[model samples]
Target: MNKMIALMLAASASALLAAAPAYAQDASYKSLTDKATADYKQAKVACDAHSGNAKKVCVEEAKVARAKAESDAVAQYRNTPRELGKARKDVANAEYDMAKAKCGDRTGTDKTTCMNDAKAAKTAALADANTGARAGTNVAQNPPATMKENCDAMDATAKAACMTRNAASSTKVAVEDSVITTKIKADLVKDNDLKALDVHVETVNGVVMLSGFVPSQAQVKKAADLARGVEGVTDVKNGLKVK
Candidate 1:
Protein backbone atom coordinates (compact mmCIF):
# COMPACT_ATOMS: atom_id res chain seq x y z
CA MET A 1 0.00 0.00 0.00
CA ASN A 2 2.80 2.40 0.82
CA LYS A 3 4.52 1.73 -2.52
CA MET A 4 1.23 2.29 -4.30
CA ILE A 5 0.76 5.61 -2.56
CA ALA A 6 4.25 6.68 -3.56
CA LEU A 7 3.52 5.85 -7.17
CA MET A 8 0.30 7.83 -7.03
CA LEU A 9 2.11 10.90 -5.71
CA ALA A 10 4.78 10.60 -8.34
CA ALA A 11 2.19 10.37 -11.06
CA SER A 12 0.45 13.46 -9.71
CA ALA A 13 3.64 15.44 -9.69
CA SER A 14 4.48 14.35 -13.19
CA ALA A 15 1.11 15.42 -14.43
CA LEU A 16 1.48 18.83 -12.82
CA LEU A 17 4.90 19.41 -14.30
CA ALA A 18 3.81 18.19 -17.68
CA ALA A 19 0.98 20.69 -17.88
CA ALA A 20 3.23 23.70 -17.36
CA PRO A 21 3.97 25.87 -20.41
CA ALA A 22 7.08 27.86 -21.33
CA TYR A 23 6.92 31.61 -21.94
CA ALA A 24 9.04 34.75 -21.98
CA GLN A 25 9.23 36.06 -18.42
CA ASP A 26 11.06 39.36 -19.05
CA ALA A 27 9.18 41.07 -21.90
CA SER A 28 7.71 44.50 -21.14
CA TYR A 29 4.50 44.42 -23.18
CA LYS A 30 2.68 47.23 -21.39
CA SER A 31 5.32 49.92 -21.77
CA LEU A 32 5.60 49.25 -25.48
CA THR A 33 1.86 49.48 -25.96
CA ASP A 34 1.71 52.72 -24.04
CA LYS A 35 4.44 54.32 -26.09
CA ALA A 36 2.73 53.22 -29.28
CA THR A 37 -0.53 54.78 -28.24
CA ALA A 38 1.16 58.03 -27.28
CA ASP A 39 3.01 58.21 -30.56
CA TYR A 40 -0.18 57.60 -32.53
CA LYS A 41 -1.93 60.41 -30.70
CA GLN A 42 0.91 62.77 -31.43
CA ALA A 43 0.91 61.82 -35.09
CA LYS A 44 -2.83 62.30 -35.33
CA VAL A 45 -2.48 65.75 -33.77
CA ALA A 46 0.11 66.68 -36.40
CA CYS A 47 -2.37 65.70 -39.06
CA ASP A 48 -4.66 68.53 -37.95
CA ALA A 49 -2.50 71.03 -39.87
CA HIS A 50 -3.35 69.41 -43.21
CA SER A 51 -6.57 69.25 -45.27
CA GLY A 52 -8.29 67.01 -47.88
CA ASN A 53 -6.06 64.23 -49.22
CA ALA A 54 -3.13 65.36 -47.06
CA LYS A 55 -5.16 65.00 -43.88
CA LYS A 56 -6.42 61.61 -45.02
CA VAL A 57 -2.89 60.48 -45.70
CA CYS A 58 -1.78 61.83 -42.32
CA VAL A 59 -4.54 59.92 -40.51
CA GLU A 60 -3.60 56.72 -42.30
CA GLU A 61 0.02 57.29 -41.33
CA ALA A 62 -1.04 57.53 -37.73
CA LYS A 63 -2.87 54.25 -38.10
CA VAL A 64 0.25 52.71 -39.58
CA ALA A 65 2.29 53.90 -36.60
CA ARG A 66 -0.16 52.37 -34.13
CA ALA A 67 -0.34 49.09 -36.07
CA LYS A 68 3.44 48.74 -36.21
CA ALA A 69 3.82 49.54 -32.53
CA GLU A 70 1.16 47.07 -31.44
CA SER A 71 2.57 44.43 -33.76
CA ASP A 72 6.00 44.74 -32.22
CA ALA A 73 4.53 44.63 -28.74
CA VAL A 74 2.57 41.50 -29.53
CA ALA A 75 5.55 39.83 -31.11
CA GLN A 76 7.71 40.52 -28.05
CA TYR A 77 5.00 39.35 -25.69
CA ARG A 78 4.56 36.10 -27.60
CA ASN A 79 8.28 35.56 -28.11
CA THR A 80 7.58 33.19 -30.96
CA PRO A 81 8.81 33.44 -34.52
CA ARG A 82 5.42 32.58 -35.97
CA GLU A 83 3.82 35.36 -33.99
CA LEU A 84 6.56 37.73 -34.99
CA GLY A 85 5.88 36.84 -38.60
CA LYS A 86 2.20 37.57 -38.17
CA ALA A 87 3.05 40.89 -36.56
CA ARG A 88 5.22 41.83 -39.51
CA LYS A 89 2.43 40.92 -41.87
CA ASP A 90 0.03 43.11 -39.93
CA VAL A 91 2.42 46.05 -40.30
CA ALA A 92 2.66 45.43 -43.98
CA ASN A 93 -1.11 45.54 -44.33
CA ALA A 94 -1.20 48.79 -42.40
CA GLU A 95 1.43 50.26 -44.66
CA TYR A 96 -0.59 49.19 -47.63
CA ASP A 97 -3.63 50.92 -46.23
CA MET A 98 -1.65 54.12 -45.79
CA ALA A 99 -0.25 53.82 -49.28
CA LYS A 100 -3.65 53.46 -50.83
CA ALA A 101 -4.78 56.50 -48.88
CA LYS A 102 -1.86 58.47 -50.29
CA CYS A 103 -2.78 57.41 -53.81
CA GLY A 104 -5.93 59.50 -53.32
CA ASP A 105 -3.88 62.67 -54.02
CA ARG A 106 -3.26 61.65 -57.67
CA THR A 107 -5.65 61.08 -60.60
CA GLY A 108 -5.88 59.07 -63.87
CA THR A 109 -3.02 56.66 -64.58
CA ASP A 110 -0.92 58.14 -61.77
CA LYS A 111 -3.39 56.92 -59.15
CA THR A 112 -3.61 53.50 -60.80
CA THR A 113 0.16 53.21 -60.81
CA CYS A 114 0.32 54.23 -57.17
CA MET A 115 -2.22 51.59 -56.14
CA ASN A 116 -0.34 48.92 -58.09
CA ASP A 117 2.88 49.89 -56.39
CA ALA A 118 1.21 49.64 -52.98
CA LYS A 119 -0.07 46.14 -53.80
CA ALA A 120 3.37 45.05 -54.93
CA ALA A 121 4.91 46.33 -51.72
CA LYS A 122 2.35 44.47 -49.62
CA THR A 123 2.93 41.28 -51.58
CA ALA A 124 6.66 41.49 -51.00
CA ALA A 125 6.14 42.10 -47.32
CA LEU A 126 3.84 39.09 -47.02
CA ALA A 127 6.43 36.90 -48.72
CA ASP A 128 8.93 37.91 -46.05
CA ALA A 129 6.42 37.15 -43.30
CA ASN A 130 5.83 33.71 -44.78
CA THR A 131 9.53 32.95 -44.69
CA GLY A 132 9.65 33.94 -41.03
CA ALA A 133 6.65 31.71 -40.27
CA ARG A 134 8.28 28.74 -41.96
CA ALA A 135 11.51 29.25 -40.05
CA GLY A 136 9.68 29.37 -36.72
CA THR A 137 7.52 26.29 -37.26
CA ASN A 138 10.39 24.04 -36.16
CA VAL A 139 10.61 25.51 -32.65
CA ALA A 140 9.79 22.22 -31.01
CA GLN A 141 12.80 20.25 -29.81
CA ASN A 142 13.58 17.07 -27.92
CA PRO A 143 12.70 16.72 -24.25
CA PRO A 144 15.19 18.06 -21.76
CA ALA A 145 18.21 16.05 -20.56
CA THR A 146 16.82 16.23 -17.05
CA MET A 147 13.91 14.02 -18.02
CA LYS A 148 16.26 11.30 -19.21
CA GLU A 149 18.51 11.70 -16.19
CA ASN A 150 15.58 11.30 -13.85
CA CYS A 151 14.66 8.02 -15.49
CA ASP A 152 18.22 6.64 -15.49
CA ALA A 153 18.28 5.68 -11.83
CA MET A 154 15.38 3.30 -12.21
CA ASP A 155 15.59 -0.43 -13.04
CA ALA A 156 15.30 -1.32 -16.75
CA THR A 157 11.55 -1.81 -16.74
CA ALA A 158 10.96 1.22 -14.53
CA LYS A 159 13.30 3.35 -16.64
CA ALA A 160 11.43 2.47 -19.82
CA ALA A 161 8.12 3.34 -18.20
CA CYS A 162 9.47 6.62 -16.84
CA MET A 163 10.94 7.70 -20.14
CA THR A 164 7.75 6.95 -22.00
CA ARG A 165 5.64 8.83 -19.50
CA ASN A 166 7.94 11.85 -19.50
CA ALA A 167 8.03 12.11 -23.26
CA ALA A 168 4.26 11.92 -23.64
CA SER A 169 3.66 14.36 -20.80
CA SER A 170 6.11 16.92 -22.15
CA THR A 171 4.57 16.98 -25.60
CA LYS A 172 1.03 17.20 -24.33
CA VAL A 173 1.87 19.93 -21.87
CA ALA A 174 3.66 22.06 -24.42
CA VAL A 175 0.91 21.91 -27.03
CA GLU A 176 -1.89 22.50 -24.52
CA ASP A 177 -0.18 25.35 -22.74
CA SER A 178 0.74 27.08 -25.99
CA VAL A 179 -2.80 26.93 -27.29
CA ILE A 180 -4.23 28.22 -24.01
CA THR A 181 -1.78 31.09 -23.79
CA THR A 182 -2.37 32.16 -27.38
CA LYS A 183 -6.13 32.10 -26.98
CA ILE A 184 -6.04 34.08 -23.78
CA LYS A 185 -3.78 36.73 -25.25
CA ALA A 186 -6.00 37.03 -28.30
CA ASP A 187 -9.05 37.57 -26.12
CA LEU A 188 -7.29 40.13 -23.96
CA VAL A 189 -6.04 42.16 -26.89
CA LYS A 190 -9.41 42.20 -28.62
CA ASP A 191 -11.20 43.68 -25.65
CA ASN A 192 -11.47 47.45 -26.09
CA ASP A 193 -11.39 48.26 -22.40
CA LEU A 194 -8.59 45.96 -21.34
CA LYS A 195 -5.00 47.08 -21.64
CA ALA A 196 -3.61 43.67 -22.58
CA LEU A 197 0.04 44.77 -22.49
CA ASP A 198 -0.34 45.54 -18.80
CA VAL A 199 -0.81 41.88 -17.97
CA HIS A 200 1.69 39.04 -17.86
CA VAL A 201 0.42 35.50 -18.44
CA GLU A 202 2.06 32.24 -17.43
CA THR A 203 0.65 28.75 -17.34
CA VAL A 204 1.59 25.91 -15.01
CA ASN A 205 -0.21 22.75 -15.92
CA GLY A 206 -3.75 23.90 -16.63
CA VAL A 207 -3.60 26.73 -14.10
CA VAL A 208 -2.91 30.27 -15.29
CA MET A 209 -1.30 33.11 -13.36
CA LEU A 210 -1.96 36.71 -14.38
CA SER A 211 0.58 39.23 -13.11
CA GLY A 212 1.31 42.92 -13.67
CA PHE A 213 -0.77 46.09 -13.34
CA VAL A 214 -4.05 47.38 -14.75
CA PRO A 215 -5.81 50.70 -14.49
CA SER A 216 -8.55 49.56 -12.09
CA GLN A 217 -9.90 46.74 -9.96
CA ALA A 218 -12.52 46.08 -12.58
CA GLN A 219 -9.87 45.47 -15.18
CA VAL A 220 -8.14 43.04 -12.86
CA LYS A 221 -11.33 41.09 -12.45
CA LYS A 222 -12.06 41.26 -16.14
CA ALA A 223 -8.64 39.96 -17.08
CA ALA A 224 -8.99 37.00 -14.75
CA ASP A 225 -12.46 36.29 -16.01
CA LEU A 226 -11.25 36.38 -19.57
CA ALA A 227 -8.47 33.95 -18.74
CA ARG A 228 -10.81 31.59 -16.96
CA GLY A 229 -13.15 31.52 -19.91
CA VAL A 230 -10.50 30.11 -22.20
CA GLU A 231 -10.50 26.40 -22.94
CA GLY A 232 -7.95 24.18 -21.09
CA VAL A 233 -7.59 26.71 -18.26
CA THR A 234 -8.30 24.77 -15.09
CA ASP A 235 -7.95 27.83 -12.83
CA VAL A 236 -6.65 31.38 -12.69
CA LYS A 237 -4.61 33.12 -10.04
CA ASN A 238 -5.02 36.84 -10.49
CA GLY A 239 -1.86 38.65 -9.40
CA LEU A 240 -2.70 41.83 -11.25
CA LYS A 241 -2.39 45.02 -9.17
CA VAL A 242 -4.36 48.22 -9.61
CA LYS A 243 -2.25 51.12 -10.81
Candidate 2:
Protein backbone atom coordinates (compact mmCIF):
# COMPACT_ATOMS: atom_id res chain seq x y z
CA MET A 1 0.00 0.00 0.00
CA ASN A 2 1.08 3.65 -0.44
CA LYS A 3 0.85 4.31 3.30
CA MET A 4 3.02 1.30 4.09
CA ILE A 5 5.72 2.45 1.63
CA ALA A 6 5.69 5.95 3.16
CA LEU A 7 6.15 4.48 6.63
CA MET A 8 9.07 2.39 5.43
CA LEU A 9 10.72 5.41 3.87
CA ALA A 10 10.32 7.39 7.09
CA ALA A 11 11.86 4.58 9.11
CA SER A 12 14.83 4.43 6.78
CA ALA A 13 15.32 8.17 7.06
CA SER A 14 15.13 8.00 10.85
CA ALA A 15 17.74 5.22 10.91
CA LEU A 16 20.08 7.24 8.72
CA LEU A 17 19.66 10.30 10.91
CA ALA A 18 20.46 8.28 14.02
CA ALA A 19 23.62 6.95 12.40
CA ALA A 20 24.96 10.32 11.22
CA PRO A 21 26.92 11.25 14.32
CA ALA A 22 28.57 7.85 14.59
CA TYR A 23 29.59 8.04 10.96
CA ALA A 24 30.97 11.53 11.38
CA GLN A 25 32.93 10.50 14.46
CA ASP A 26 34.43 7.58 12.60
CA ALA A 27 35.42 9.78 9.70
CA SER A 28 36.97 12.39 11.98
CA TYR A 29 39.09 9.84 13.82
CA LYS A 30 40.16 8.30 10.54
CA SER A 31 41.51 11.66 9.47
CA LEU A 32 43.34 11.98 12.77
CA THR A 33 44.96 8.57 12.39
CA ASP A 34 46.01 9.32 8.81
CA LYS A 35 47.57 12.63 9.77
CA ALA A 36 49.36 11.04 12.69
CA THR A 37 50.70 8.34 10.42
CA ALA A 38 52.01 10.90 7.93
CA ASP A 39 53.62 12.94 10.67
CA TYR A 40 55.25 9.84 12.17
CA LYS A 41 56.74 8.96 8.84
CA GLN A 42 58.18 12.45 8.44
CA ALA A 43 59.67 12.35 11.94
CA LYS A 44 61.23 8.95 11.36
CA VAL A 45 62.72 10.20 8.11
CA ALA A 46 64.23 13.16 9.96
CA CYS A 47 65.87 10.73 12.41
CA ASP A 48 67.73 9.10 9.50
CA ALA A 49 69.49 12.41 8.89
CA HIS A 50 71.55 11.82 12.08
CA SER A 51 74.10 9.12 12.95
CA GLY A 52 75.23 6.79 15.76
CA ASN A 53 73.73 7.36 19.20
CA ALA A 54 71.96 10.50 18.06
CA LYS A 55 70.17 8.67 15.27
CA LYS A 56 69.36 5.80 17.63
CA VAL A 57 67.84 8.17 20.13
CA CYS A 58 65.95 10.02 17.39
CA VAL A 59 64.57 6.79 15.98
CA GLU A 60 63.44 5.59 19.38
CA GLU A 61 61.77 8.92 20.16
CA ALA A 62 59.97 8.92 16.82
CA LYS A 63 58.66 5.39 17.28
CA VAL A 64 57.56 6.12 20.84
CA ALA A 65 55.79 9.31 19.84
CA ARG A 66 54.02 7.56 16.98
CA ALA A 67 52.87 4.74 19.22
CA LYS A 68 51.50 7.20 21.75
CA ALA A 69 49.69 9.14 19.03
CA GLU A 70 48.11 6.00 17.58
CA SER A 71 46.98 4.77 20.95
CA ASP A 72 45.41 8.11 21.74
CA ALA A 73 43.72 8.23 18.35
CA VAL A 74 42.24 4.80 18.86
CA ALA A 75 41.03 5.77 22.31
CA GLN A 76 39.37 8.89 20.92
CA TYR A 77 37.71 6.84 18.23
CA ARG A 78 36.42 4.33 20.76
CA ASN A 79 35.59 6.95 23.41
CA THR A 80 35.45 4.35 26.15
CA PRO A 81 37.09 4.36 29.56
CA ARG A 82 38.82 1.06 28.86
CA GLU A 83 40.33 2.42 25.65
CA LEU A 84 41.39 5.60 27.40
CA GLY A 85 43.19 3.51 30.01
CA LYS A 86 44.97 1.65 27.26
CA ALA A 87 46.03 4.94 25.71
CA ARG A 88 47.51 6.04 29.02
CA LYS A 89 49.41 2.77 29.28
CA ASP A 90 50.72 3.24 25.76
CA VAL A 91 52.03 6.68 26.73
CA ALA A 92 53.82 5.23 29.73
CA ASN A 93 55.33 2.54 27.54
CA ALA A 94 56.52 5.15 25.07
CA GLU A 95 58.03 7.20 27.87
CA TYR A 96 59.88 4.10 29.05
CA ASP A 97 61.33 3.66 25.56
CA MET A 98 62.55 7.24 25.56
CA ALA A 99 63.93 6.80 29.05
CA LYS A 100 65.84 3.66 28.12
CA ALA A 101 67.24 5.32 25.02
CA LYS A 102 68.34 8.37 27.00
CA CYS A 103 69.97 6.12 29.56
CA GLY A 104 72.00 4.61 26.73
CA ASP A 105 73.88 7.90 26.49
CA ARG A 106 75.16 7.61 30.06
CA THR A 107 77.63 5.22 31.77
CA GLY A 108 78.45 3.54 35.05
CA THR A 109 76.24 4.34 38.05
CA ASP A 110 74.59 7.21 36.17
CA LYS A 111 73.15 4.79 33.63
CA THR A 112 71.94 2.52 36.40
CA THR A 113 70.35 5.44 38.18
CA CYS A 114 68.72 6.69 34.98
CA MET A 115 67.32 3.26 34.22
CA ASN A 116 65.98 2.91 37.75
CA ASP A 117 64.39 6.33 37.71
CA ALA A 118 62.80 5.69 34.33
CA LYS A 119 61.34 2.40 35.51
CA ALA A 120 60.01 4.03 38.64
CA ALA A 121 58.42 6.86 36.68
CA LYS A 122 56.82 4.47 34.22
CA THR A 123 55.54 2.25 37.02
CA ALA A 124 54.07 5.16 38.96
CA ALA A 125 52.35 6.73 35.95
CA LEU A 126 50.91 3.42 34.71
CA ALA A 127 49.76 2.49 38.21
CA ASP A 128 48.02 5.81 38.59
CA ALA A 129 46.27 5.46 35.24
CA ASN A 130 45.17 1.90 36.01
CA THR A 131 43.88 2.99 39.39
CA GLY A 132 41.64 5.50 37.65
CA ALA A 133 40.54 2.88 35.12
CA ARG A 134 39.64 0.48 37.94
CA ALA A 135 37.70 3.18 39.69
CA GLY A 136 35.76 3.86 36.51
CA THR A 137 35.04 0.16 36.02
CA ASN A 138 33.60 -0.33 39.51
CA VAL A 139 31.74 2.79 40.55
CA ALA A 140 29.52 1.07 43.06
CA GLN A 141 31.46 0.36 46.24
CA ASN A 142 30.97 0.41 49.99
CA PRO A 143 30.33 3.99 51.05
CA PRO A 144 31.39 4.86 54.60
CA ALA A 145 28.58 4.84 57.18
CA THR A 146 30.47 7.14 59.53
CA MET A 147 28.44 10.16 58.55
CA LYS A 148 25.11 8.74 59.77
CA GLU A 149 26.73 7.32 62.88
CA ASN A 150 28.16 10.71 63.82
CA CYS A 151 24.84 12.45 63.09
CA ASP A 152 22.99 9.94 65.35
CA ALA A 153 25.19 10.97 68.30
CA MET A 154 24.27 14.64 67.97
CA ASP A 155 21.55 16.30 70.11
CA ALA A 156 18.74 18.26 68.39
CA THR A 157 20.42 21.69 68.80
CA ALA A 158 23.78 20.31 67.68
CA LYS A 159 22.14 18.59 64.72
CA ALA A 160 20.61 21.92 63.67
CA ALA A 161 23.96 23.65 63.95
CA CYS A 162 25.64 20.89 61.94
CA MET A 163 23.06 21.19 59.18
CA THR A 164 23.56 24.97 58.99
CA ARG A 165 27.33 24.64 58.94
CA ASN A 166 27.23 21.89 56.31
CA ALA A 167 25.02 24.03 54.09
CA ALA A 168 27.45 26.95 54.44
CA SER A 169 30.38 24.67 53.71
CA SER A 170 28.74 23.43 50.49
CA THR A 171 28.14 27.00 49.32
CA LYS A 172 31.74 27.92 50.09
CA VAL A 173 32.94 24.90 48.14
CA ALA A 174 30.88 25.91 45.10
CA VAL A 175 32.24 29.47 45.15
CA GLU A 176 35.79 28.23 45.44
CA ASP A 177 35.31 25.67 42.69
CA SER A 178 34.10 28.33 40.26
CA VAL A 179 36.96 30.69 41.08
CA ILE A 180 39.57 27.95 40.72
CA THR A 181 38.13 26.77 37.43
CA THR A 182 38.28 30.29 36.02
CA LYS A 183 41.82 30.85 37.22
CA ILE A 184 43.06 27.56 35.81
CA LYS A 185 41.44 28.18 32.44
CA ALA A 186 42.90 31.68 32.31
CA ASP A 187 46.34 30.37 33.13
CA LEU A 188 46.00 27.62 30.55
CA VAL A 189 45.23 30.25 27.95
CA LYS A 190 48.45 32.03 28.85
CA ASP A 191 51.01 29.21 29.02
CA ASN A 192 52.50 28.25 25.64
CA ASP A 193 52.85 24.60 26.71
CA LEU A 194 49.11 24.46 27.52
CA LYS A 195 47.47 27.31 25.62
CA ALA A 196 46.75 25.46 22.39
CA LEU A 197 45.34 22.46 24.27
CA ASP A 198 41.84 24.01 24.59
CA VAL A 199 41.03 21.40 27.22
CA HIS A 200 37.71 21.30 29.01
CA VAL A 201 38.17 22.42 32.62
CA GLU A 202 35.60 21.85 35.34
CA THR A 203 35.69 21.88 39.13
CA VAL A 204 33.70 20.33 41.95
CA ASN A 205 34.48 20.67 45.64
CA GLY A 206 37.90 22.08 44.75
CA VAL A 207 38.81 19.13 42.53
CA VAL A 208 39.49 19.94 38.85
CA MET A 209 38.41 17.79 35.91
CA LEU A 210 40.22 18.13 32.57
CA SER A 211 38.66 16.50 29.56
CA GLY A 212 39.54 17.05 25.92
CA PHE A 213 42.34 16.32 23.45
CA VAL A 214 45.94 17.44 23.77
CA PRO A 215 48.78 17.29 21.21
CA SER A 216 51.00 14.95 23.24
CA GLN A 217 51.60 13.10 26.50
CA ALA A 218 53.50 16.06 27.89
CA GLN A 219 50.50 18.29 27.37
CA VAL A 220 48.28 15.76 29.14
CA LYS A 221 50.44 15.99 32.27
CA LYS A 222 50.75 19.74 31.89
CA ALA A 223 46.96 20.11 31.92
CA ALA A 224 46.67 18.53 35.36
CA ASP A 225 49.88 20.13 36.60
CA LEU A 226 48.76 23.60 35.62
CA ALA A 227 45.37 23.14 37.27
CA ARG A 228 46.96 21.86 40.49
CA GLY A 229 49.17 24.94 40.63
CA VAL A 230 46.07 27.08 41.03
CA GLU A 231 45.68 28.37 44.58
CA GLY A 232 42.34 26.84 45.59
CA VAL A 233 42.40 23.59 43.62
CA THR A 234 42.52 20.57 45.92
CA ASP A 235 43.21 17.95 43.27
CA VAL A 236 43.16 17.41 39.49
CA LYS A 237 41.65 14.48 37.62
CA ASN A 238 42.87 14.29 34.04
CA GLY A 239 40.36 12.94 31.55
CA LEU A 240 42.18 14.62 28.69
CA LYS A 241 42.46 12.34 25.67
CA VAL A 242 45.83 12.68 23.91
CA LYS A 243 46.24 13.09 20.18
The sequence of per-residue lDDT tens digits that candidate 1 reaches over residues 29-85 is 777888998999999999999999899888887887687778757644664666767
> In model 1, what lDDT does residue 41 have?
92
Shift in Å, residue 124, candidate 1: 1.4
Scored by Cα lDDT, where does model 2 land?
0.69
User: What is the overall TM-score of model 2 with all chains considered together?
Assistant: 0.62
TM-score on alpha carbons, each prediction: 0.46, 0.62
In model 2, which regions exceed 4 Å deviation? 71-75, 137-225, 229-234, 237-243
Kindly report which residue stretches of model 1 are placed more than 4 angstroms away from their true locations once superposed: 1-27, 137-243
Task: Give the local distance difference test score of model 1.
Answer: 0.71
**Candidate 2, run of 10 with poorest lDDT:** 137-146
Give the per-residue lDDT of model 2 (tens digit) for 1-243. Answer: 999999999999999999999999899888887887888789989988999888887877776667666755654465454765676677677767766777787899988987887787677658755865675421112112232234456899998887676555555554665688779979999998888654656554566767544568888888888888999777887866443
Could you tell me the lDDT of residue 129 within candidate 1?
66
